[model samples]
Target: MFALVDCNNFYASCERLFRPDLQGRPIVVLSNNDGCVVARSAEAKRLGIKMAVPLFQVQEQIDRENVAVFSSNYALYGDISARVMTILEQEAPAVEVYSIDEAFLDLSGLAPHFSLVEYGLQIKRRVYQYTGIHVSVGIAPTKTLAKLANHAAKQYPATQGVVDLSDPQRQRRLLGLMPLREVWGVGRRLSRRLEQQGVTTALALADCSPAWIRSHYSVTLERTVRELNGQPCMELEACPPPRQQILCSRSFSHRITEYNDMRSAIAQYSARAAEKLREQNHLARVVTVFIRTNPHSQHERFYSNSASRILGVPSADSRRLTATALRLLKSIWQPGHRYMKAGLMLSDLYLPGHFQPSLFEAPESPAAMRLMQTVDNINHSGLGQVRFAGELLSSGWQMQRNHLSPAYTTRWDQLPVVRA
Candidate 1:
């Protein structure tokens, strides 16, 4: 058996976690740089705040509705997510973190007499009890069905946020009423194609022959169909695959037209990308940088350009990455174009000690690795931050966020204060 636990309105919930007065309020969380609406609370949805809509497009509506808006507070969200996952790891037999807002559990090892529905309810209760974040629990025979059950848990309150589809009969009943697009892996385009082919419901797609599905669509879709039919085609991944590439980019809060500003932004982004590369214990051989004008600006012409350079040696050193990125930025720098975004991508990554160095190229020394490790430890400990000389102190090129919330849980200085 499989169980999926998903946080309810994750970002918006995080914002309201410490603010009980916000209960039933219309709240929306904006994406990084305050560019768009990424998460909306139940009240916000009722107010017609669409997901991914640009903040500018809905600014008037938000004000008129007196909607509460918050910029993405990643530090707070990550901390809360960790707390929720930690609770799950202790509550379940085996666990797989499917996303920041979702996790799956293995319940096959439980005693046959144990009640799946009751256990799912317990998970839902404990997560809320400990973290003040509500979650929906779905239990099914297969992971795909578990995902569907989770959707049902969220859609209908009658379930009380717990749904179990272990019985084949119950699975059929739910799938018969579910649209093709609601199936775990079926996307919009795929759902449209399946609808045209007369597979309008999840049950219809599930009834198709696996062989025929494989020949018509991809092996992935075939697996989805098999899983929908109560066959476990996908197993829990205890350890997720390592990322092949790391890219860090952000839309600037304001337009920039100067060369120095672009250099500053790329320098900081490179340092960030290198930090991630080292976090994964990998080194990158290729460095790419890009800058662009705002695509949504009506009066300005859209412009974007990118440049990449291969490193002489794979290295995760921030100094080296920053230098390479600055050089790339110099090559692509355009004068008076009003660049609104800049970023860096590190690719062709290799785990440390996994590959041989070229005859003329020298690998990063052991001391260098230890240095980066120490820097990371210091930064993570919240004691202080380490930076390269090339990175500018004043982040003028950085994306400005006007409505950012305090990092209540992560930053010592930002903690909320209560007084009599």
Candidate 2:
């Protein structure tokens, strides 16, 4: 058996963890640069504040509805996610972290000990006790059905955070009621195609001919059907590999017209991407920089640009990547356009120490390696950030907007007090 555990309103719940005052209030977390609504509490959704609604478009509605808004605080969210995962690891024998707020636990052998519903309730209670966040769990014989069962558990309160779809009659009944698009692998395009074929529900899709599905759509869709029918096509991997492409980009709070400011933004993004690359022990041979103007403003011109540079040798070094990224920025930089966003993408990645040495570029010296190690250690220890590069401390770059919440968990100065 497989079980899916998903946190309800993950980002908003993270905020409520520290600020208990926000419980039952309308709350929303903005995306980068305070651009749009990325996450909303149940109360906010009750007011019909749709997800991804632009902040400017909903500003008046927000004020009229008395909605409480917050900028994205990833540090707090990441910390809370870690805590949740830690609790899960202790309770489950084998666990797979599906996303920032979701996980799958293998329950194949534990059925002899306790009922599935009781096991799920214990998990929910323990997670809430540790983190003050609520979660829902679903159990099924296959991963696809487990996901569907989880969706059902969220909607029906009688399930009490646990829905089991292993029974044949119950599985058919539940699948018949669920919309086709709610299935794990059926996207909007596939859903429309399935509807055109007169298959409008999960049960209908599952009953479709496998040969036709294989011919019309991908093999993945065929696998989804098998999984829906209680055949496990997907196995839980213990340790998934890191991502191959690392992209770090953001829209500015305000449009940037100056070339220096654009360069600084690009450099900052490249430095961040490089940090992630180093963390995963990988390096990239290709670096891409791009800038774009606001597409929504009628007064602004729509302009976008990109430039790619191939490194002589793949590198995770911040200095090398930032220098190459700045050069790419200069190539794509246009003088007159007001750029609203910029980003950096590092691709063609490989393990750091395993790359083929290039004859043209000199290998990293001992001194350089030591300096990089020292810089990374100091940043990790909170002595200071990576300031060896001038671009990091340049005056033209804008500050990140994570100013609202007190640093309750990370910083020593922001720790909460307790009476003895």
Candidate 3:
């Protein structure tokens, strides 16, 4: 059996964790720059304020409805997500962290020891008790069905956020009732295409001939069909596989035109990507730097360029990556155009001990490895206070988070205040 555990209105819930007064009230979390609605509480959803709607368009409604609005507080959300994932890992024998707000647990072997539904309830309760965040759990024989059960748990309050679909009849009935778009593998475009083929429901898609589905849509769709039919095509992955590439990029809070600022942004991104590479114990042989002017600014001329370099020798050191990224940025950086975004990608990743050695270049020194590890440890412990000299103290290219809430969980100064 597989169980999907998903946080309920995760961003809004994180905001409400510090502001308990917002409970049972309409709340919405905005995207970066307070651009659009990225998350909404149940009350906000009830008011029919859809996700991704521009904030300006709904300001009147938000005021009239007295909805609590917050900017994305990723630091708080990340810390809370880590706590929730830790609890899941402690309770479940194996857990696959699907996203920041969701995970899949392998519960097949534990079914014989206890009631799965009861176990799910225990997990849900423990998570709430520990984190002050509510979660919905859905258990089924396959990941796809588990996803559907989770949807039902969230959609219907009578389920109380726990649903088990081990029974074939119940699984079939739920699948029959759900729209094609609600299935785990189906997206908007695929849902529209499937609808054109007269497969408008999960059950309808599952009932289609596997051969025909494969011939038309692809093997992935066929696998979804089988999984929907109660076969376990996807299994819980206890450990995430090493990433083949690591990308670090972000849109700037304001457009930047200076070469130094662009170099600073790319340096920062490269350093971040290199840290990720070291965390996964991988070496990247290639680094790509990309820069772009805002396309949305129609009055200004648009410009975008990317440059890639293959390192003489693969290394996970942030200093080397940052240097290479800065060099590449110098090549692509254009004057006069305001750059809206810049990024770095570390690719051609290889395991530490498995890569081919360069004949001309010397192997990375043990001292350098220790230094990198020390820097990483210090930064991790200090919440990313350490930085390379190439990084700017205050780059204009920082993300626009105008309405961001304090990092209550991660920052000492922003810790929740307790009233006497």
Candidate 4:
């Protein structure tokens, strides 16, 4: 058996975690630079506030409905997500964290001792008691059916956020009611093609021949079809696979034209990308820098460019990545253009101890590794932050976050204040 647990309105729920006064209120969290709606509360959705809608276009509706707005605070969201994942990991035999707000759990052996529905209720209660985040749990024999069960839990309030599809009859009925696109692996394009072929529901897709689905669409869709028939085609992965690429980019709070300011943004992004590489214990042989002006601005001539450089040796050292990124930035940056965004990408990754070393090249120095570890420790502690020289203080490259909530869990000064 498998179970899928998903946090309800993840970003909005995180915002409401500390602000109890906003319960049952309409709220929305904006994306980077407060650009567009990324997450909305149920009340906000009821008010016809669509996802990804620009704030300017919804300002009147927001005012009329007294909607709460917030800028994206990743530090806050990441901390809360870590806590939620911790609870899930402790409760389940094996867990696969699918996303920041979703996880899959293995429940193959526990049924002999306890009811699966009761166990699901326990997970919900414990998570809410500990983290103040509501979650929906869906249990089934396969990952595909687990996802479908989770969708049913979320859509129908009578389920109370728990649905089990272990019974074949119930699974078929639920799949019959589900749109084809709502299946785990069917995407928008696949859904359209399936619709044209008169396969518009989950049951319709599952009823197709597995070999026919594989030949017409893909092996992945064939696996989805089998899984929908209650056969397990995927297993829970306790350890996630290493990322093939690491990217760090963000839209700036304001447009930048000067090459030096853009250099600072690239350097910051490279440092972040390097941190991720080190966290995963991998090295990157290629670094790329990209910068672009706002294409939507009709008054200015549009410009966008990117350049990649191969490192002499694959490395996860921030200092080396930052220097390489600055060189790439210099090669691609066009002066006199108002750049809206800049970022860095690290690719061609290899595990640190597994890759063959060059006969002439020296290995990473212990002193350099120690220094980076110390810096990372300080930053992770949230006591203070240390930066490389290229990451200039007051660089004016920060993203817009005018309506950001306080970092209630990660920052010392921003801790929630209690008054009598």
Give the best candidate by TM-score: 4
Instruction: Put down candidate 3 lDDT per residue, 43-128, tens digits, no spaces.
Output: 99999999999999999999999998888988899999999999999997899999999999988788788888898899999999
Off by over 4 Å in 3: none
Quote model 4's TM-score.
0.97
Candidate 2 per-residue C-alpha lDDT over 226-313 given as tens digits, one digit per residue, 9 for 90 to 100? 8888889998766777898999987777778888777767777877888888788787899999889988889977998899988778
Kindly indicate the candidate among 1 and 2 with the higher lDDT: 1
lDDT of each: 0.89, 0.85, 0.89, 0.91
Off by over 4 Å in 2: 296-301, 360-370, 392-403, 417-420
Q: Quote the lDDT for 244 in model 2.
A: 85
Which pairs clash inside model 4? none
120 in model 2: Cα distance from truth in Å? 1.1
Note the residue pairs that clash in candidate 1.
none
User: How would you encode candidate 4's per-residue C-alpha lDDT over 100-198 as one tens digit per residue?
Assistant: 999999999888898999999999999999999999999999999999999999999999999999999999999999999899879999999999999
Which residue runs does candidate 4 get wrong by more than 4 Å?
Answer: none
What RMSD value applies to candidate 2? Answer: 2.3
Off by over 4 Å in 1: 111-113, 295-302
